[model samples]
Target: MKIEKRWIISFLIISAAAIAGLFWPEAVETPEILSQFGKTEDIVPADVAWLLTASCLVLLMTPGLSFFYGGMVGKKNVISTMLQSFICLGVVTLLWVIVGFSLAFGDPIGFHIDGRFYSVVGNPFSFAFMDHVGVLPHLKMASTIPFMLFALFQMKFAIITPAIITGSFAERVRFISYLFFICLFTLLIYAPLCHSVWHPNGILGTYFGVKDFAGGTVVHMSAGFAALAGVLVLGKRKNSSHIPTNIPFVLLGTGMLWFGWFGFNAGSALAANGTAAMAFATTTTASAAAMLTWIFFERLNGRKVSALGACVGAVVGLVAITPAAGYVTVPQSIFFGFITAIVSNLVLNAKAMKKIDDTLDVFACHGVGGIMGMILTAIFAQGENASLLHGGWNVFAHHMMALLLVSAFTFFGSIILFRITNAIIPLRVSEASEQLGLDISQHDESLDPNRHVPMTILDLAK
Candidate 1:
């Protein structure tokens, strides 16, 4: 279809939906608690304001990631690589609104046949189409923000998680297949992990007391491990060249991701309180420390400090601190950043030596960093809650157990998902098409407008 016709159709459909929404029974009422400005309220306005702002910041990270990943790929595949992340913004958001949120955060379903299953996942029907997820504060969850806002905030995380995996098979995967796999991944892998770790009655949280201040396990580790699986399934790119097309774009993406990460970590606090403040401070400290540590290590390895190394190191720091941001102090985060940068750097080097084609080092940065963060969080998590450093042996043990379980589940489950998606739509593109470049073969687009010179009437007639 022509682009103009497509836009007209989309506009008409959206306009019709807006008109229909105005006539529907008013199920979504602004809560009385939020309406009162001058009096004491159940929902704090400050919390609402902060959470909303944080949500927007988190949303920006996906495009930031697109640029980051895009710049790292060959110029021939940059648009294809970027679109893989950009499409998640649209595809994942729709999936979340439909049933994804319910599956991850709706009321837990209990079984009494034995002791209790407690809920493997939230009741999908309970909040299907966001039935009760409205402006009213969901007392069971964040009590200060609208339930709808909370869901929307969570949606940003959902959008970015699968986007993270595209780095694994950037140049070789078919775009349609990529889209299907991410959608399937969100429902099968991402949602279940989110429910298990974050939901109040979740197995890991309620039964194991595994603490993930943000999404060490759910987002970072899952994406990382799943990325490993994707690399294994998709195999190596035909041209496994490590040449980066755009260092400046990588820097821009790094800056955006670093900015967005404040929301990614602090927003998990769900309240504008001391915890949020602590999280923000720790996130900043950890990222800076990691960036410096990475370049320092590069110098030691006899390689000149490069822009790509700094960006990757900064990102690794952000991943390492995510699980500990709200729980640990700034000094602890400095250690977290420094240690994680070293660990990821070592693993990345090993991966390159082994010739593993995990493009962009998703597993090395997110997976390894997240596991390190989870373990560190158990050691240094301060406050009233006890950590291993404070004699909380059981909590430490549970986090270790949770880490293993999450790693195994994500890795194996992603393999199964890749096979399933591949059965329906071939995952890898034809070698001929890949040689021609995904930009021209798949999308008929390119970063350089001059790649296709204009054809004269004589050429067209020919």
Candidate 2:
């Protein structure tokens, strides 16, 4: 049979279409035996509109995260924190277009679902999707948009990841080190891992049966571990004890994050129908639960819950639900959010228990929450293969183990990259720079009223 180039690309994509089946610990294969409805030629405009909107929504989350993170830090560091998220959008978007997407979805790249690549499976060089010069590849899940838009949406995930790392080294990191870490982390740490879980040709499906409705494992846990590694490398901020800076900004950031998240979770459904509506419901419920949980814990354990606790609780809920948004019920989501709030908050407060100096509790919130989501997905996924809970419950432990492996992989990669970036350029600001604060030291600006002219009626008159 003579194979057209288009056919070759399509065939190659079809062969490599199941990466998350491996360490997924419990992938929902929709086993051939279970039954499936054949593809309909009917075009769905609603689905298309939903996906396009969702991509934009996910993109907005970067700035939303910036505001959230910036508010938590001192006034001196606001722009720096926001800049980290914004820069991630620029760099990772470029990288994904060039090679990150292909690296993840193209070939095995030495990763396997079990131990070896199967015949139906393939190597990067062997896959048509791997060849950037061929006709653009298409995914059934998102055929409505230009593949470019799909790539852009996924790129948002990569962008926000390193931004999560900013919380660990916020006050003291050098700009050069920050740039160094962000570039390398997106490529080495994030790319392959994304391939493992989301890439059509991934190990997650081939090896373990991990089920991440969104990014409980990849985005949250991975970034959380990176946060831990970052603080370990950078040490604590100069001032550790007090409120350190502004509390009002943190509240403002949290509000914006909550607003933008409607798009983040609902949009993940990649459609605007029932599942997306369900995700929207769970997202709101879990956030509310986590926030109240934090206040209760604070009142019981500490003197009172501060502005920081409320904001962080909201974030933890968001992180925990990311991986299981479409799969679990609201009751399960509430359980997931509440548990994550308690656990992550404790880890952060356990402070000084380990020498690592996380600047803003990234690991406690994002990392821990992500792990909790991934594990619960295995327990609560209700469709297709569902979890063993559909019948038996043996797979729960396997789910935890998978999260651990992914966390370990992300942590080690982060540490190695941190060391390499440190060697290339110092990873921290000079003591003088730290004293000056990143906005002034790195960007050479400030929030001071005297620094710039105010926009008054007289100024407009000019």
Candidate 3:
């Protein structure tokens, strides 16, 4: 049993980081002087409790996504596909604790552009090793909850975003190389986009006034575009067409995702208030509308209604409604679901899209859905954040700019990261590995006990 050199190097790097973390000082030396975070009195118990629950709910989504993707791939690839999503839970969490959280939410590091100091990314050392991340409230970000709780909640979002991309190149990606790509994607692409859109001093948030209430842009759009880039870089799998391994798994995953989304959307409010309730309502309404619209739209096209179609439609609606969940009315949410589902469904069926071997149609469903959501958010937002429909042309214009910027950045940045990873460790598995199936070739394990494991790549070379 010869261990690969890459595995040895990866282990050493991870172990070194863990050892360093153990030696790092606590964020706060004294419990009595927690005032550095904010007034302890400002922490609201209800908000804290709700955020804790929401974090757990959001964490569940990654495993749910694993099942959703696992069911869609070939039987031989199911375990490998599922593990890709599950691995992120451990990998991204550790990365986040190290510097991912800091790179996303730390103090602004930017330069002057047209007399405005536009912050593009956060300072990586600001919260490095969870420094200064404690129980007290962050006066600006989420005043009602512990700063650490907010970081943990956001960590769930970070974990799921990269997992979403695994579906695009599923069944063929080398597991170890996939690991490297995710770390790069999170640091270079995800953290920067997250900072630009969600951070208080970020260019898109403060300068452009872009309103992504949840993460249509940060999570879905980034994942979708990155998935597209991955498809381009990895090319098509050797044998692309296959029947799903388990429809029941897909249905179960969909249910879990739908149930967990209430927390994903409502939790964005960072409170247990009227805004949270409204967001919860809109999330439900949008997904319902999308589910019905998907099946009925398929019937209109002379295609039989399918459970898979319904699940995809419902997920699209969730993606489309995410940016507008708190900003738009419940009635408006129905329109978001209806329109987004129609658009993504059309894209999914497009001849051009079919040519691109995106194994799971991640781009059509999530990328297209997210773009529609952002555009609709710019058109339908109300009250103080009035959109195009409400005569706030400025907000609408900025949103359009932000959309283009985000798309280009995520797509191109991902391609670069993929290339870099390939250079370090080949991104695609060998043809033999693909033919044998990743379960047996990559993991040396299989769902079928009777299935034979192939020789190692090194042995095959001889």
**Per-residue lDDT of 1-462 in model 3, one digit per residue for the tens?**
878899999999999998999898766545543444687899999999999999999999999999999999999899999999999999999999999999999888987777878788989988999888888788778788999999999999999999999999999999999999999999999998899888888899978889899999999999999999999999988798999999999999999899889889999999999999999999999999999999999999999999999999999999999999999999999999999999999999999888889999999999999999999999999876479998889999999999999999999999999999999999998887888788877787788888764465535521
Backbone clash count, each prediction separately:
0, 26, 0
Quick one: ranking by TM-score, best first? 3, 1, 2
Candidate 2 residue spans exceeding 4 A from truth: 1-43, 111-141, 242-244, 353-355, 392-394, 449-462
What tens-digit string does per-residue lDDT give for candidate 2 at 1-462?
Answer: 445464465456434443422222432434441122122333356866776777777777777778777777777777887788778876677556555665555545653335665221223332222232222224443544444455566767777788878888887887656876887887677777777777554566445667776777778888989988888887777764434366666777777667667767887776668999999888888888898898788899955877778888888888888888888889988987898888877887885634566777788888888877887788778865567667425456667667778988999889999999888778887766676668777776677746643334212221
TM-score of 1: 0.89
Model 2 local distance difference test score: 0.71
| Residue-level error in angstroms, candidate 2, position 147 | 2.1
Which structure among the candidates has the greatest lDDT?
Answer: 3
Error of 2 at 173 (Å): 0.7
Considering lDDT, where higher is better, how would the candidates rank from best to worst? 3, 1, 2
Q: 1-462 in candidate 1: lDDT tens per residue?
A: 235453466567657655654664544434653342222266788998999999999999999999999999998899999999999998888778777998999767654335756566788866666666776677667777888889999999999999999998888998878877897899989988899888877888777777799898899999999999999998888888858999898999999999999899999999998999999999999999999999999999999999999999999999999988998988999999999999999999894624878878899999999899999999999855557998889889988888899999999999999999899778998886677778877777788887772334213211
Determine which window of 10 residues in candidate 2 has minimal summed lDDT.
126-135
Kindly report which residue stretches of model 1 are placed more than 4 angstroms away from their true locations once superposed. Answer: 1-40, 110-117, 351-353, 453-462
